[model samples]
Target: MATKSNSTKTSSSKKGKMNLKDIPFSKERLIELFRQMLLGRRFEEKCGQQYQMKKFSGFCHLYIGQEAVAVGSIAALEIGKDYVFTTYRDHVHALILGISAKEVMAELFMKRTGSSHGKGGSMHFYNGKTRFMGGNGIVGGHTPLATGAAFASKYRGDGAVALCYMGDAAVNQGTFHESLNMAGLWGLPIVYIVENNIYGMGTSTERSCAQPELWKRTGDAYNIPGRQVNGMDMLEVYEATRQAVEDARNGQPVFLEMLCYRYRGHSMSDPATTYRTKDEVGQWRMKDPIERLKEQFPTVFTESMVKDMEEEIKQEVADSIKFAEDSELPELSDIWTDVCVDYPGYPGREASDNKYEFPYEQLENAKK
Candidate 1:
């Protein structure tokens, strides 16, 4: 499979902006990027379909238009060596980070086969084995966690870097400032990326932010270098993030603001049209990132090749859905498992001698 990301390899940048001819990557590599991006798009489209069918309950956020930012930026970091943290909008991030579509779909279906054993649901996705630290539901809740992950790396004398992803709305939270201040003061290896998708839920960036240029203002406050890039352009996002990851590896923290937009509402519930206009949405659709990349490889990505890739993505999604459906639901007794609680003198004779055993049938009524 073309799952290996080109961003894993290092590439030196030239003085000016990059074009298709000057992207410093091979045709196969570019096509792979396109393929992964299409996979993410199709995965989210399936999510939307399942949500409408009520396959699962609870809030669902789709990363429909922001595929370039997630795929391109993630491609720059080392898979296991580097860590990624994000907010509630994390399905695409999980997919790009090598989490199988089957596992992610299982999570959406709340099956026992999910990454978090079907417990975390759509918002709280945890896969510590891959160092993807899971997604936090609260705004700016995971910034300090990202900072701590970076601190642990530096403390252990490892060269790992933490990539903290947040939406534009989270920049205003107190943890954002506190985490950045510590990261800058301690020189932690972390890259803070703001996915500035123009809207914070229903409000526009212009209306919600006192300083609209998040990369500049936020970075300047912490004495960190920052850059704003065209998030819609996958190549631009890749290059910018690659450099930022390099800087972090060299013991420097950096910030980035990606100017992108979401095609769907903030969540499944929000219609997304009440605050924004249809004309504005159509204008952004015109700049569809996948179509733009396809234009760059008209000869290489012939009609047949593009069709094959699309069909492959469709089948991949279908397989994932079947996997989720086939998976069994968690047993009732599962509630008592995987829960970490501290008991006084645990693992000692004092605790063991004090333990009481109750019959499974009477357990519920024996609470008193």
Candidate 2:
């Protein structure tokens, strides 16, 4: 696969603009990046089709326009070494991490064959082999968990790093600060990536954030190194993420904010818009990342090649949906099977579940 990243792999300027001239690695690599991106787009469209047929019936956050970050970061990462955790918009990361489309589709269908065995639906994807953490649903709760994962990596003296992904809305939460402080103070090997999509669930950036220059957020006592990149550009994201991961492995944690946009609503449940204007959306549509990259990448591939790639991705996505549709749903018996470790006598047969209540009470009791 062509590397196709925009990263210079050199020290960035203080403002953190990546030198993208070094990203396009090889023809094969560019095509690979293009294929992965097409797959992500097709997956979202397939999800919409499945949902319309009632095969998937929960909160589904599609990764239609947000493919570059996942593809870029995952390209820079190793399956077993680096860990990735992200918000509910995580199918792209899971897909990039080698989770089977059959299992992912089955999970969306609420079948026992799901990656999380039907327990973790669209928002709770998991795969142990790839080291992807979860499709966390809480607003900003997963930041500390990312820190802890890096802390664990450090504790084991493994050079592995943790890649924490979240959105612009999440940066406003207290955990974002707390986790950054802990990671910087203790020097955890973590890359805090904020996918700034410009809108956080209908809220404008300036209206919600006190200071929307989100990359500069690492300036507090923790002194985390921060950078801003063009998220829509895979090369830009790849360049920024490569350095950030390298810096983390060297004991300097990095915070990165990428400016991007979502082409759709918050989820399948939400109408396309209640906050932003169509004119604004159309303006962004002019800068379509996929189209721009298709031209930028292939010296030989043509418009027909682009069309052929689209067709191939659509076929794969269609097959994935069929696999999910034909797949069976989790049995009622499966409902009780994954409750707890003691739910079964066998040591390895144990399963995990979403805690019944917020774990605060349990934490308070333990403190007492």
Best by lDDT: 1
Per-residue CA lDDT of candidate 1, range 1-368, in tens? Answer: 01211112122322233356877578788888898889989999999999999999899999998989988898898888899999999998988777899999999999999987888889988777678987789989999999999999999979999999999999889999999999988888999989999888998878988878776664446767767878887887898889889888878888888888999999999998789999999999987878767775577677999999999999999999999999999876565456666433333433435444446678767865
TM-score of each: 0.87, 0.86
Q: Pick the candidate with the highest TM-score.
A: 1
- lDDT score, candidate 1, position 206: 88
- Local distance difference test, per candidate? 0.84, 0.79
Instruction: Itemize residue pairs with steric clashes in candidate 2.
Output: 1-29, 2-28, 2-29, 2-30, 5-23, 6-235, 7-239
Error of 1 at 99 (Å): 1.2
Candidate 2, residues 181-244: lDDT per residue as tens digits? 8998888899998998888888978889988888766745466877787777777688788878
